[model samples]
Target: NSILGFQGNRDLALNMINWLSSDEDLISIRPKDPADNRITLSRAQMQGLFYTSVILMPLAIVLAGVSVWWRRR
Candidate 1:
């Protein structure tokens, strides 16, 4: 019941069910290791990404829209 959110939730549940049913052979199989691929961002890098995506991007989009509107008028 506590295997929720795990990568091998199904396998874990199956193993637990097998163990409970005394199916030792079925419970012999083990789940594969989940990959650990993480990115470590520096403070500067984090700030740069935040500004670029959150601020600069929306500002650029708005400016472009306003410019187009002005040109059209």
Candidate 2:
């Protein structure tokens, strides 16, 4: 369980870093002015997040519940 949780967290962190690194607007060499607040998410990226969260969250919950139930039994 601990190993699975660690791997899940690592996967999420890697995905976040990859997404941030790939965003051209977010990786400006010159720091943007504080007033600039433009954020964009492409359709595909939004869909990916939606799907990943929807799928992974439930799977994680189910796994956790089963783990607890197994331990109690």
Candidate 3:
């Protein structure tokens, strides 16, 4: 399950990057359009980002606090 989720996410991320980096026109990428110019992210992607922020932000704050404490020591 985890591996499948990872592969699905990897594919989604790749598609997003491809769409974002493409040189196609903006209006051509709308939902009503016929071109495949838009990429979609799954709920896992959203949750992954949220979880990453939740974990990393506090870790960064702790690291910064430690750095300040060490400097003052």
Per-model TM-score versus the true fold: 0.53, 0.41, 0.38
The global Cα lDDT (0 to 1) of model 3 is 0.68
Per-residue alpha-carbon lDDT of model 3 for 41-63, expressed as tens digits?
Answer: 79999788887799888899999
Clashing pairs in 2: none
| Best of the candidates, lDDT | 1
Tens digit of lDDT per residue, candidate 2, span 7-53?
35655555666677885444323333477678699999989888889
Ranking of all candidate structures by their lDDT, best first: 1, 2, 3
Residue 68 lDDT (model 2): 100
- Per-residue alpha-carbon lDDT of candidate 1 for residues 1-73, written as tens digits (9 for 90 to 100): 5656577777778889998999878975575778899999999999999999999999999999999999999
Against the true structure, candidate 1 reaches a TM-score of 0.53
RMSD of 2: 20.2
TM-score of 2: 0.41
Clashing residue pairs found in predicted model 3: none
